[model samples]
Target: MKFLSFSILLMILHFTTYSQTIDTAGYIRGEMHSSDDSLVGYFKFDHTFGQNGQSVWYKKDLQTTKTKRFQTYKYDYFTSDSLYMELFEVMPYGFGEIRVMVPRVINGPIQLFYFPHSTPFAIIQPKNEPYLIKTANWKKRVSYRKFKRDMREVLGESSLVYKQIEQETLKYDDIPMIVRLANMNADESTIQDYIAHKKSAATSTN
Candidate 1:
């Protein structure tokens, strides 16, 4: 009888440890939406892990303990810090479907996405353009002139940021802010304000 009790205790401990390892403590709660923006259902998912390159999603209710894997959903209305952020499942050039798109500026004059797994690490779509443009990360083999030319084409001559690119004031790291400013049709004053704020924030963090 004592041997049976000891074996049951060991089994309980092992299962408890396994459950703790895979629980939804840090998972983000979101509403999965279809391509047409139709609400599917509420779910919580951790993008960090899944089976066969897909993330595991669980029903939002903790008591039910139901889970699922998804690939057909277009995007999720993920909540972080009370802000609704869209997480897109995009197929980057020369890559598989494993990567996802984190939009820097969505539905803007110039759309930019940050792809962590791809070579360029960023993708751009110019206003009213059907095809997507790929870029190389600055830390890679791409040159400054190429990066500037790409930005100029995307920003256009009418944009204030185009002039900044012409004078070589912008770098690859500034792509996120550059896209945002260009979309805003930012003037010299607005651009300067954003630059100053960003510098101040960066300094404070350090």
Candidate 2:
């Protein structure tokens, strides 16, 4: 009886642990539609994990009155979890492009997932190094620096617009607790800073 109870307990523990692990092969898919209820586009995704790290592949198709646009991306590949989460870049080919992957907390099993969104044309890169910039522990300083650097890289030399976006981002960075409670807001600011910086840089180069 004692041995049988122990075996049952072990099985339960094993199942619980396995349940907590994310299946990288899993994906979430959906479509964009017009207000008139017409399908405007479709998206497919495949995320996987391996010895190297995590990788995300995305494909998008958009239909318009004039033409159809299609694009594919393989992004957020990294060797470390922190780097994978913070530093991976989104690179796309063709017309339909999505540059940002918003991290989402998966309920029940407790896993992280990415939801894609469209953004301006730019190179996607990690916000900052995890050790140097701890978004969790030192959110204000880390977020500020991350936003500043992203703006510089993306916008380049547009001092005016860079300063504008920097000020706005700094406001959000000041409230670490608020950021933690509302992760979506923080994610939005991160992407905004990236795009703002990219636009500023493009203008300067031109």
User: How many pairs of residues collide in each model?
Assistant: 0, 8
lDDT score for residue 22 of model 2: 28
TM-scores for candidates 1 onward, in order: 0.51, 0.22
Report lDDT (Cα) of residue 125, candidate 2: 51
Q: Which residue segments of model 2 deviate by more than 4 Å?
A: 1-23, 26-29, 33-43, 46-69, 72-98, 104-176, 180-206
Residue 100, model 1, lDDT: 38
Worst 10 residues of 1 by lDDT: 133-142
Write down the worst ten-residue block by lDDT for model 2: 131-140
TM-score, prediction 1: 0.51
lDDT of each: 0.47, 0.33
Clashing pairs in 1: none
Error of 1 at 197 (Å): 8.6
lDDT by residue for model 2 over 56-143, one digit each (tens)? 4323433323433222223321222221222223333354322332232221111222322222233765343211122322311223
- Give the per-residue Cα lDDT of candidate 1 at 70: 64
lDDT of 1 by residue, 122-206 (tens): 3553222111323333111123347766665666677788777676565665665676677778789877675566566568899
